[model samples]
Target: MALCVMMFLLVIPASLAQEDMDDKVFLFPKDKHTDHVSLTPNITKPLEKFSVCLYFFRDFLRNLNLFSLASPGTGNTFYFADSSSTNTVHMNQDSALFRTNMEPYEWKHACVTWNSDTGVVKLWVNGKLYPRRVCMKGSSIPAETSMVLGQKQDSFEKKSTTYPFVGEISDVHMWDYVLTPEEMLQALNKNAHGNIINWNSLLYEIKGDILVLPKSRCPYQITSKSYVDNGEDVDNGEDVDNGEDVDNGEDVDNGEDVDNGEDVDNGEDVDNGEDVDNGEDVDNGEDVDNGQGCL
Candidate 1:
């Protein structure tokens, strides 16, 4: 009877577990619609670290402008810029191309990993580590920025713009800590097949065209590219006219004047033996041979 009771207890809980799993809801965006999947409020811890992985395929004729996985807040943000003007990635914040140029019909499978304590951010574009430099130090994230996918939050406008994403997004995943490179690759493979592996007993799954995972910290690598530096106008040093710095306002010696026997002395007609007022001809009929004659 004791053995029978033990089996009954185990079976009851297993059945309940199956039921609970079945009850979990998976939501996905409608097909052929540009729907954004926003994270719930309070999904991230106040100051912990986190990371996110997204698999997307571009379909537009032009490459997209900016691809971002930014948390809703003032400080925490991560995005990839197509600054090269050639579909290559760049991290410069000041590149005009960054804001104006967009590559069409290019797909991306990218990941951003962030650590709040260290303030280090890393970006992986198609499993390759893209180069960048960080400027923003780790800081507490503001509570107002809403986590968004596929579009940029124009804070000044105070509304979500219709520059909606035009592509297929799947296998979105998030973790509370930085993922190792190997783990990231594995995740990518699993995502391609619409599968998620169990990590730390956390259940991960791709539900149709949407992904739902437990929120941890904001998963963004603080870019090594310093926005502060970007704001500073680069002074290539003024194009000071070549001879403007000479002490006596001397004409620049290009060697041609010396070889061609041209007058180098402020155009003063020495041959006439008098300062030709305002460069007018002072034909001193004698033709005094001053050796320095006008060509």
Candidate 2:
């Protein structure tokens, strides 16, 4: 009888265990027809530290824009606040875009962790560290103005509702405390390991990737492309048996049968559990089989 035992254990690192309790996740509307989603105070608190992570995809270059309010009454504007010029993060006012260009389909992951005491903000993309610039004394983000994705929140001179984000967004998670680069990377990686120092807990998890307002909140579409198979470049040796192939010697008995020219039961003739051939069987000994015939 054979007995089998199996056990399963899940080892969660201290870092990932901390963010598991964090609350404060939200998904913006996917209105590709519009330019922005209101980043209202009701949706987000003011003056308090928080973090936001979301996956974003844009089909048209014009539909890719990030809008925020720097101060009260200053009005919402693009992160760069310019349409006539081009920036590393911004695209032309009229350009066709698609999420396919952005590897990993959707914004595989994006996160913003901030600290008020030090006034430091960290952004992460695809589990990798991103550049950051401190907000000067008066340039800090205001609490009143709404935040918008895909397009500028505040109406600008050339603002048009024609171009909007046309991709999917998902796996959005946020925290109130500033997460370390290591912690942020773990969260963005979606791996269940890593340390989150001062996180308050998750706020929400907006399921799905489309928003149409009242009927749905955000305006966007969910379309997936076929996964491309990247061929392996490294060479693994070809399949073949490389072990030594040897032949048995005739005089050595080599487990051959002498009675009828058939292989012997133990490399030598044996009868009734005892060697029946001549004493030659004992003299030509190599290795004998116990109860079983030698091969």
Q: Please tell me which predicted candidate would have the highest lDDT against the true structure.
A: 1
Task: Give lDDT tens digits, candidate 2, residues 38-96.
Answer: 33223344444556665443333443444333344544322322111222222112221
Query: For each candidate, what is the lDDT?
Result: 0.40, 0.37
Off by over 4 Å in 2: 1-45, 61-63, 66-71, 77-106, 114-119, 138-142, 155-163, 189-295
Candidate 2 lDDT for residue 268: 33
**Tens digits of per-residue lDDT for model 1, 122-238:** 667667765533423455444343444454444411224434455444455566567788887876564322112122222332212553422222112122321212132111232
TM-score per candidate: 0.41, 0.41
Give the 10-residue window scoring lowest on summed lDDT in candidate 1: 286-295
Lowest summed-lDDT stretch of 10 residues in model 2? 286-295
TM-score of candidate 2 relative to the true fold: 0.41
- Model 2 scores a C-alpha lDDT of 0.37
